[model samples]
Target: MRSRLAARLAALGACLLLTASCTSVSGTGGRPRPTGPGSLWNPSAGQPSPSGANAPFDADAALRRIKRLGFTADDEPGVLRKLPGPLRAIHSHCTGSVDGHCVIVLFFHGNDYVGYDAHGTGNSSVVSQDGTTVTLSYPHFKPGDPMCCASGGTREYRARWTDGKVTFSPPLPGNPNYEEPSP
Candidate 1:
C-alpha cells in the first residue's frame, strides 16, 4: 500500500511540474517577458485597450447586433477569422458588399459591435494586422489591364482603428465595378 501511495504522489508531482513549465512565460531571470505584441501579457496592438474590450466574445450577441447595422438580412453574418490583440476582433464575411468584396474585419468591445475595417475592393481579400494597423493586400492593375487579371504587382493598404472607428491611412481603393446593393 505504501509503494502504491508513493507512485501516486510521484505521478502527481510530475503532472504539476509539466503544468508549471508550460505556464511559465518569464525569461531566464524569472522576470516576465517584455510586454508588447508578442509578450505573454498585453498582446494587444500596443494601443490602450478600449473599455471592456478584453471581455469574452459572445457570438450570438454579436450576430444580433450586426443584423441591426443595416448590412444585410439575406447573407448570414459569419466569422471569417478572429484577430489577436487587446481588442477582440473578428473578420466577418457576409453580404451587402458594394465593392464586390464581402469580407471585413469587425471590431468588438466585449461582444458589443464597435466598428470595422473599410470595405475592400473585389480584388482585396488578404488582411493582416500589426500593432494597431490592419493591412489589406489586393491585386494592382496598370492601365489597360483586364479586370480579371492584374499584371501590376500587388498593392497593399493599411487602416488603423482610432477614436472608436477605422480610418484608412491611404484613401480607399476606387472600384469601377462598384454597385449599390439593391433594396
Candidate 2:
C-alpha cells in the first residue's frame, strides 16, 4: 500500500508538470509560436527601417540647390502656373515652390521691389522678410492680446517664406493677426 501511494504521487507530479507547460502552448513543442508572422530569433535582424532608409533631406542644402536653379533672365517672363495662387492678390504675379513650401511675391518691372500695400486702414502691421520666414510683428499687442494670448502670443500674424520685401507698414488696428490664411 505504501508503494502504491508513492507511485500515485509521482504520476500526479508528472501530470501537473506537463499541464503547466503545455496548457498554454501555442504551437511549438515547448515554446509558443509567434503570434503574427514573427520570428523568435532575429526577425528584424536583417530588415531595414520602415522610413528614411536613405539620407534625410537637408533644407539648407536644398535651398542652395534651388538658388543654383534660380530663374534665368533668358527664359520668357510669365506667371507661375504651378504654385497655389497668391495669398494676397496684387497687381503682379510671380510665385515659386520649394520642397512643397511656397512663396508668392508680387513680380514687378525690372529693379522694382515688391512692397506691402497695408491692407486698407486700421490693419497696419509690419512684415519682416529675411530670406525665408516672414515675421509679422504687431508690437502694439503685447502678450495680453485678446485672441493670440493663449496661442499666437503677441504676434498678430505670421507670414512665412516671404520671397519678396515688405517695404511699407500696413495700417493695422482693431484687428490682430493681420495676414489672412494663405489663399
Candidate 3:
C-alpha cells in the first residue's frame, strides 16, 4: 500500500538524518547504517572497518550498550529461556574415559577465551577455524566431572565442531545430560 511505502520512506529518511549527524548506533532505531561516500551517507570514511577480533574489546562498553537496549542482567535468563538454545553445558566423550562423554562451556569474556565445566580443568587448548584440540596438563580421572578434584587428568582431544555440534572420539560416551551445539 502507498501508506506503508510512505512510512518506510519516512523511517529511511530519519535514519539518514541520524547518520548525517555521525551518531553512535546505540540508541533508538540503532542499526548501523551502511558506509558510503555521499555527504549524508558516509559517517566515517577511511577510518577503519568496525568488526572482528581486532576490534576494541570493551566488556563494559558492550555491557552498557546491551543494557541501554533495555536488557537487565536478570533478563538474560528469560531471553535465553525463550530461545531454543545451544552452548549449554553438554557434550559427549566428556569423561575422557577410554569411552566416556564430556561437556564444556566456552565463552568469550571480552575476547579472553575460556572453556570450563563438565570437561577438564581450564588449560592448554588450540582452537582454530578448522577444529579445537583441548589438551589437559594432566589426565582427567573422570572425563566430564571436574569438581570431583580427582587429580592427574591428561589427554589429547581432537574435536571437530560442525554446525555447532561436537564429535570427538567415537562411541562418544552416551549421556542423558549431554548435548552439543547443533552441528
Candidate 4:
C-alpha cells in the first residue's frame, strides 16, 4: 500500500510539471494570443481584419444615413422573407490619397433597400477615383430580379465631399466590363 501511494504521488508530480511547462511555453508575454476565426495570427482563417484605422467603413451608419434620406426597406413580407436578415446590405471601403487628401469610397449593396433610384441589380464597386471625385459603379436591373443573377446595364455615380459631407451625383452610363482595381 505504501509503494502504491508513493507511485500515485509521483504520477501527480509529473503531471504538474508537464502542465507547468506547457503553460510557460504558451505564454505570449502577458497578452492572450488570438485563437479563433478572423484572428490576425490566422490569416487564412477568415476575412482579414481591416488594415489602417479608416478601413472597412461602417455599413450600419451608412444605412442609418440613407434611412434619414427617406429610404426604407419595402414592406413586402414575401420579399423580406427571402432576404438573409433584417439588414441584407453589405459594404466595402477603399481608402486612398486624392489631391493629397485621404479619400474613402464606400460601396454598399443598393438593392437591399427599396424606393431608391440607385438600387443596383448587382454588387457595387469602387471603379475609380480622381483628385476630387470617387466613382461607384453597379448594374441596373429590372424590377423583382435579384442583384446576383441579372442586370440591365451599368451605371456609375460619382461621390464628392461637399461642406464636409459626401454627396453623390446622378449616375452616368458605365461599362459593365470595368472591374474595380484593388486599393
Candidate 5:
C-alpha cells in the first residue's frame, strides 16, 4: 500500500499549498476543518458568542428539519442561509403558496431547533444581515399601486436574538396566510 500512502501524502501536500492550512487532513476526524474566514465550517465566526449559540449552523440538518416540518420547495429553487447567532433562514417558493414564496427564520442551539422568528408578509425580502441583526424589507401596496411598483414604498423590520428568543424591532408585519406554530 505504499502507492496509496504516497497518493494521500501528495493530496495532503496540495491541500496545504492551496489553503495554507493542514487542519483539514491532520487530525479532523473526518469533520470539515475550518480553513479560513467565511468558511462554512466556521459559519458563525465573528458573531457574538452567546452561551451555546457559537456552534456552527448546519445548513444540511436545517434543511432536513425544515422538510420534516412540512415546508418544502418541491422542484422550485429556494434559499437556505446562515444568519447571525444560531439562526438559519429559508426562503422557499412553494409552501402551500399561491403567489409562491415565504421567508422563515429558525433558531438553534447546537443540534436542537429552539425557536423561530414571527412570520412575515409573503412578499418579504431580506435586506441585509450583519453583526447580530437581520433586516427584512417588505413592499407596501397602496390602492392604486401596481404590482410592479408599490406606491407605498417599503417597510423594514430588524430582528435580533435576545434573552433566548427573537425580538423584532417595530415587530414583524402580519402574515395573513400563516398557519402552524414554530417547532
Candidate 6:
C-alpha cells in the first residue's frame, strides 16, 4: 500500500509539472499562446492603428499630417477632391519592433488619394512610421503604365522615427526585388 501511494503521488507531481511547463501566463495574466507575427504584441504586423495612446502609427492622424505637408489632391493633376473614407483601403501593411518602432505603408491609387484604384497601376506606396528607422522597397510605376504591366523601376524609401516625429529619406535607386528591412 505504501509503495502504491508513493507511485500515485509521483505520477500526480509529474502531471502537474508537465501542465505547468506546457503553459505560461502573459503579463496581462492571460494564457500565453503562440500568436502570429501581426498579433496584438506586434501591432505593426497587421493593419494600421486608428488611434491609441502613443501608438506608433495612427492612420488618420498620419493622413492629416501628410495633407499638411502639401501632399493633397491639389498637388496631383489628375487627383480631384480628397475622398472621405476609411483609410484602411489605402493601407498596405505595417511592421515593427517591440520597442514601439514601426513602419506602415499606404498605397495610393494612381498615386492619388482620391479613390480606391486597383493595385499596381500608377500606385505609390508611402511608408511612414514612429519608431526606429526602417527601409522599404517598392515598385515605382511610370506615367500611364497599364495596371497589369511591370513597374518602370524600383525605389527604396527609408523612414526614421525620433522624438514623436518621423523623417523620410529621399528615394534611393534600387532593384524591384530588393528586400525590405525587418522591423
Q: Clash totals for all models, in order?
A: 1, 10, 21, 0, 0, 1
Reference-based TM-score of each model: 0.44, 0.20, 0.23, 0.29, 0.51, 0.27
Error of 1 at 84 (Å): 1.8
Residues 1-183 of candidate 1 have per-residue lDDT tens digits of: 999999999999998865453322344222111122332122242234244556544556656545443233222334422444434445444434454345444555444455544433344543666436667665666677776777766656666656655555565533312322122
lDDT values, one for every candidate: 0.47, 0.29, 0.32, 0.36, 0.49, 0.35
Candidate 5 per-residue C-alpha lDDT over 63-151 given as tens digits, one digit per residue, 9 for 90 to 100: 66555443553322223433554443344332454544344444444444544443443455557765367776666666665546666
Let me know the TM-score candidate 6 reaches against the reference structure.
0.27
| Candidate 4 backbone overlaps, count | 0
Candidate order by lDDT, highest to lowest?
5, 1, 4, 6, 3, 2
Give me the candidate number with maximum TM-score: 5
Off by over 4 Å in 5: 1-51, 73-84, 96-98, 101-120, 144-149, 176-183
Off by over 4 Å in 2: 1-110, 115-117, 121-128, 139-153, 160-183
Candidate 4: tens digits of C-alpha lDDT, residues 1-102: 999999999999999865453222133222111233321122232233344212443445444533333233222334333333211332222112122111
Candidate 1: 10-residue stretch with minimal lDDT? 31-40
Pairs of colliding residues, candidate 6: 44-94
Better of 1 and 6 by lDDT: 1
TM-score of 5: 0.51
- In terms of lDDT, the poorest run of 10 residues in model 4 is 94-103
lDDT of 1: 0.47
Between the candidate structures 3 and 4, which one is better when assessed by lDDT?
A: 4
Query: How many Å off is the CA of 125 in candidate 3?
Result: 5.5
Measured with C-alpha atoms, the lDDT of residue 20 in candidate 6 is 59
- Candidate 4 segments whose C-alpha is farther than 4 A from its true place: 1-122, 144-146, 171-183
